[model samples]
Target: MSKIIDTAHVFFFVVGLEVRQEFAHGALRDTSRARLAVIAGVASVALPALVYVLVVGAAGAEGIEGWGAVVGTDTAFMLGALAIVGPRLSGQLRVFLLTLTVVDDFLAVSIIGIFYSEEIRIVPLLVALACLLALWLLGRSRQWSAAPYVLIVLGLWLATLSSGVHASLAGMIAGLLIPAYPTRRHKVVAARQLFRDFWQSPSASSARAVGRGLSRGVSVNERLHEYLRLPTALLAVPIFALANAGVDLRGGLLVDSLGSPVTWGVVAGLVLGKLLGIGLATLLAVRLGAGRLPEGVGMGSVFGGAALSGIGFTVSLLIIGLAFGTTSDLGRQATLGVFVAMVLACVLGWAIFKVAARRWGEETADLPMTLEPPVDPEVDHIRGPEDAQLTLVEFVDFECPFCAHATGSWEDLHERFGDDLRYVVRHLPHHPHGPIAARAAEAAANQGMFWPWLDFVFTRQHALERDNLVDYAVELGLDVETFTEDLDSAEVAKRVERDAASAADSGAHATPTFFVEGCRLLGSYDARTLTAMLESSRRGTRTQEIPA
Candidate 1:
């Protein structure tokens, strides 16, 4: 039963990891905040260990072995609790906590591998290393098929198990090696071409070909994550809980655990230690110019989140089993401590958020919802009639494949609404050449050719380097010398910056985010869905104007 639980936990953990997306969206996007998060995460773990050592004076190996139980934050439970009881708008705060927890999980797993593994077996270790190399080679080959990767990862897990290293480590290592990349425009185009062929022929062979093309367009990491996320969350985790969480408290064990130093040490380490460690670290980091809080997430909100971070349920339980045998008295005591800490953490977090809301008025936890610096015809790049009743504003990046694909959606809306709709595009430079491409568009706007420049660049998203921009200028019939000079001009740069600043202020983080009549559109932005939403909004406007 234990071995089965361990295997399932490892498999789900690997499937749940979205390494590239997590770093790109959470940490790398905000370096200073990520640094602060790392510091806070370290402090959150380190301070608890220190607390345990202090509480359990003359720390014996047995007493110290339990330190790993305090190192991880249960990401699923913590996030769910926040959604239910946290501030109403918690998007940015959620991102911040997620970044911190990623570092927390990494450290916990590393500690398990370093401190808890049994005697090393060299032969099996070599086999594990070879399996890892094979997985790496498969990733580098850019193969979309999932079977080879799955088989290699299974071999890796088996080898690691035989090597006396925790097989869970194999899952983490294999997940990290899997290649992840942005959806390429060329691949998307190729997939669409395949679909067109299927549409014309309509046979099983053609249908299978379309399926293969569609799968090939997406990376294996993304495909696996998408398909595995639900099962990992709803099925595997619950099974793990059932197998590991049953504790027999009938033999005076509950009463004995209440007085145990190990029990109190685990509780104190999580509840009090996480609060002070994370809260103080964040304050010190900001004071030392390390990083500011996510916009609208005040210091008080950080404290609340810090309190919630103490709910280290899953990983803590896993570590407890690793540190002490399942039948040990100390294991039961540690489990009791975890339950206590969870309850205490929840109460503390709720109290903090309630106090912060009433006392500090720091209620909001996400970026602002309304459009900042509302669209102005004189300054914004507007299409269709300036006085059109319906307005669609898009924050776009030229180098973003999604934004390029959204060109069809934009055109569809334009064709449908024609004179009744106005479309505005704003710069949100998220890719490598995003800023430069935006600047080129602005320079074209200087010569009254913004729309044409936009059309040309969106179609050529695969190439947006400096040379490409220059070529686009020549193709658009602009004076090459003037266009080139304007491309680097401070005025053009400022124009793009203005749009970017507006995007940030309006809570647009990703490319191709849209707003309809000043309200940020949520969910899918396909043409059909957007059309329905627009019509609904238009009717609502008419109803309001009828003088209710």
Candidate 2:
């Protein structure tokens, strides 16, 4: 039963790890802040372990080796609590916390393997090392098939178990080595062609070809994460918790735990240590110019998140099992401490968030909802009359394929509402060539040919080099000398930067984000959906004019 429970824990931990990696990859835009998040995560682990050791050593307790219990945050429980007690729009704060917990979990697992594992066997250890090498090679080769990787990982787990190192370490290592990347435009186009072929000829072979094309378009890491996240979170984690969380409280055990130094050490390490460690490290990082806090996420939100990081239940329980036998007296004491700390952490987090909201006046924890610096006909590039009743604003990145796909939707809407709708374009570059492409457009706008340049560039996304941009200017009949000069001018660069700043303020993280009638659109930017939304907005405006 114990072996089965351990295997279940390892499996679910790996699944959670992959999901967390996806979040970290998407959220970490600023490299400096990413480094600060890592520093703060290290502090969260080191400080708690130090505090636990000091408290236990002071009390002369025999279970001082159990300091690893306070070194990790329960990703599941912490996220669940955050949803209940955290600020309403906590996108940036959630990013910061997710990045920090990734580091926290890595350190906790390393501690378990190093400090708690039994005597290691040399032959099995060598076998595990070879398996890890094969996994790395498979990732390097970009193998889309999941079967080869799965077989190697299973063998790695068995070898690690036989070597007497904690088997969960294999899961962590395998997950990190798995490559993750955004789907390329060419691959997506290929998949679409394959689907069309299948549609034209209905047969098992054609259907299988379509499936293979679609699977190859996405990275194996993402495929596995999507397949495994729900089952692991809802089923495996709960079962593992049930198997390990049984503690008898009859007789004097409960009373004895109240006086046990090991109990207080865990409570203090988690509740006090995490708050002070993460909070102080964040402040120091900012002061030292490591990075500023994420936009819309103030210091108050940081402290509130720090308080919630104290609910170290899942990994804490696992470490407790490894440090002391599950049925031992010391294990029960530590378990009691974990339960007490969870309650205290949640209450503390709630109080901090409430105070931050009232005292700091920072009610919104995400980017601003409405567009910043409302549109100006005199300054902005407009496609229709300035006095039009309806407005559609799009933040665009020329290098993005999805933005290219959205041009058709814009044209369809233009035909439907001509003269009654005005369209505005803003820069929100997300690719490496995005800034230069935006600058090129701005330079063309100086020549009174911005719209024509936009139409031409979207059709030639494959060739956006510097020379190609100059050729495009000549093709568009602009003064080649003036266009070249303006492309490199500081003013043109600033123009793109201003639009990007507005995008940040307006909460546009991805290209092709649309705003209609001053409200950000939430989902489905297809032509039909956008038209319905526009019609609804027009109706609402007319209704307001009818006096109550």
Candidate 3:
């Protein structure tokens, strides 16, 4: 009974990342890719489960049907496998596997809530729904206190527990309700204004106001995700694993299970089922024009990725607990089978990945995972000390929301590192408004006001029209006539062309591709990483570089 409570705590923390940054990942956007994910994810579960069914039916197994255990793909174990494989794996393989796993985890949680319930309690379920509604309302409110929400979550958790719905489902439910929009423009501007006030006053009262203002800039979802992340990953997950993963394998149970249908089902299903299901689904998707393989993810890489997807532990354990009595002879045999299958899956997947990756001409180990023509100091725009030890480069597109977000990281870097870091910005000009904004910045650069113009663009990216760009020039005290002329000047156009060409060549196809110490930083990063990267550069640390 307490196991459900603790597992919910751990699993919710794992899945709640969706409300903050998880939705922002590239694979989540396309309807085609999302459909592909659903297919692959469902197949990954269903195929394994089919083997369980077939073996149980054929052997006339009694008192247990533990198909649910084989359906889970353990995210933690899969990530551990990736770490063991080193960072030389292609980006496409990582993204596809991650998407598949996340989708399947959600699906499994939904199944648990729907299929694994005890006697239903209508009143408690309604009460839980009401509490969730309150959570939703509070999440949308401009003014909020963590205490109220915490109390409500307690209410919701208790109600969910009483209602016979899996308590862990509450986490996923709450996550689905949390708003995922970016930090809004007006809110950011207001935070800056509040900071401006506090900066001038330098008092405890004003500092409180500034802090509240700054807090308002982040979504409730993002803050909660960060706050709950540490204990969830380090404490809750390990505790749940410790409580469940122990198996008494000192006798004939192991040998008996080797002939048991349950044992063979788990081993064969997770290994062979996942490989064929994920690979064939992907191949079928491409043939049906549903989705294409991500770049650098060949057929062989898909084979490797699917093999890695067989690592199922946490959720599988949860399903086993739900399926049968732990002390029953059948359940004990099932547990032994699970342990044996887990080991086999890991070893088999690793072996398949090595062979498949080798066949694809991918380096198996120790390759410098970085793009060629490494980031150099020679760029279009430069700020900070010319002799700084590290060069921080960004491929900027003013119209891109991510580039606007990148400004926060850049400002934090400049303020903290000062003379130790040289900040370089170059244009990608990929969007409709990008060329105009780039030209405007260049014109401002002629007046030694480039940074100011860029700061304006970062804050007001949606307003980067021709008239607005000109208005920004006036605000910055630049000569309107000269600025207007420079927007179309041959030299400015050539500069934009040169930077665009250089950025394209450097694998900066995406906006805000950052290079720290000549090594590209992929995915999302925060201010702390920026500081650490600068420190690492100063210390001449050999940073891990993967092919971009």
Candidate 4:
């Protein structure tokens, strides 16, 4: 009973992510790509239902049909398989696989809501909808903090749980409604606008003396790539794994259910069906000219990815909970299948991928070439002292809200350590407002006002328009004559271009990518994690300095 409840809760959490990623990913503006993405998402839900029907048909009416209709593979099981494959596939192949899996998940969850659900309590669902509406309004108004979102999301989840809907739906609905990172953008805009106003105003003194005291007021996608990559890489997915992976063997009946037909069906579906489905689909797509083959991924690697797809731990557990009710023999059988399939798939996939990758030649993506348009005067020669004790390399987009947050974090670190840290900020302008912002940062750097401008941007990060960048430079007491000229200078453009290429080379698929010393720092780190890494680095430096 407890396990069923736990599994349901985990399912709800993932559903929330699915919803958020679906709606927010492209729904606001409603582009053709966005519409297609949603359609693809909705269509994918059939995989689980088909599996359920097949199993039930095989069992006949005498066998149990379970409670809720859902029957799906586990997410933890799939990811565990991928982990075993290691870096055998090229980055592109890995990304493609990740996305397809997410789409498959989206489909499975939709099946749960549309087919398996027993009741429709409109009031609670409406109430949940209202909460999301309120959050959306706040986010649009540029209230970009994650605090209120966190609190309200909890309430909504509980409400959904009590309202007879799956609680994970709460997560999906709420995540979509909450803004990704708004506060930082609001700050950037406010800061740049303030600086702009100061710049245009007539200066009674030299440009150096003009408005140095100005204060700050405030602050997707190539979806296929991120869609495939983020779900597994993100913390939310991992959290789901930890929560859903536990299966207590203390119960005797569950242990005995391994002999059941339902158990065999689920295990076979994941271990066999996933491999066939994914591998067949991929091969067909390539053969029919729907998609090209990714580099360095051999037939063996493809098979490995397919094999790992059978590790259906998280999603399969959810289906089991919905299908078998609590503490039943069927549920126990399903659980066993999930555990065994995941382990077997992971081990087998890893061996195959490793062997194939070794045979195929280790070629990487041409990241630098694909990142940005070419330029005459390359800025790749801006090298820092190689012998520095500590290096903090950051890839930022001046217009990015997270970049503003990162800028503040960088400043705090610099203030704390002073000369002990050598900070290098690189440009990574992504779509729309990105290039404009990069130009602004580069212009500021030319006049030695880069730090000040960066502080203002972080303080108020949203107003990074092309015009705003120039105006902010003028407001920062930079010589307008020099700054304006430099803004259009080939050198400035080249610098940003070089930064973009370097960011690509460093394995940065998104903005705010950070490297401390040499190792890549994964995900969003708070101050404490950064401090810990820094402290650890210091200890290492001391050890090296000792003549060992």
The digit string of per-residue lDDT tens for model 4 on 278-305 reads 6665665556655544433445666677
Q: Please identify model 3 stretches exceeding 4 Å from their true place.
A: 24-27, 86-99, 113-118, 140-148, 196-204, 292-302, 361-390, 399-423, 429-432, 439-463, 467-513, 522-539, 542-548
For all candidates in order, the CA lDDT equals 0.79, 0.81, 0.71, 0.55
Summed backbone clashes in each candidate are 0, 0, 6, 30
Distance from true location, Cα of 86 in model 4, Å = 5.0
| lDDT of candidate 1 over 400-503, digit per residue (tens) | 87772345898788778898898899999988999999999999999999998888788888898899899988888999999999999999999999999999
lDDT of 4: 0.55
* Candidate 3 residue pairs in clash (backbone atoms < 3 Å): 74-312, 369-545, 369-546, 369-547, 370-546, 370-547
Q: What is the alpha-carbon lDDT of model 3 when measured against the actual structure?
A: 0.71
Deviation in angstroms for 301 in model 1? 3.6
The TM-score, computed over Cα atoms with residue i paired to residue i, of candidate 1 is 0.84
Q: Residues 171-197, candidate 3: write the lDDT tens digits.
A: 666665665556665677788898898
Please provide the root mean square deviation of candidate 4 (C-alpha atoms, Å): 10.4
lDDT of 1: 0.79
Off by over 4 Å in 2: 1-25, 119-125, 157-164, 244-246, 291-295, 364-369, 384-391, 405-407, 412-422, 430-432, 465-467, 479-491, 516-548
Cα RMSD, each candidate: 4.9, 4.8, 5.2, 10.4
Model 2 weakest lDDT span, ten residues long: 539-548
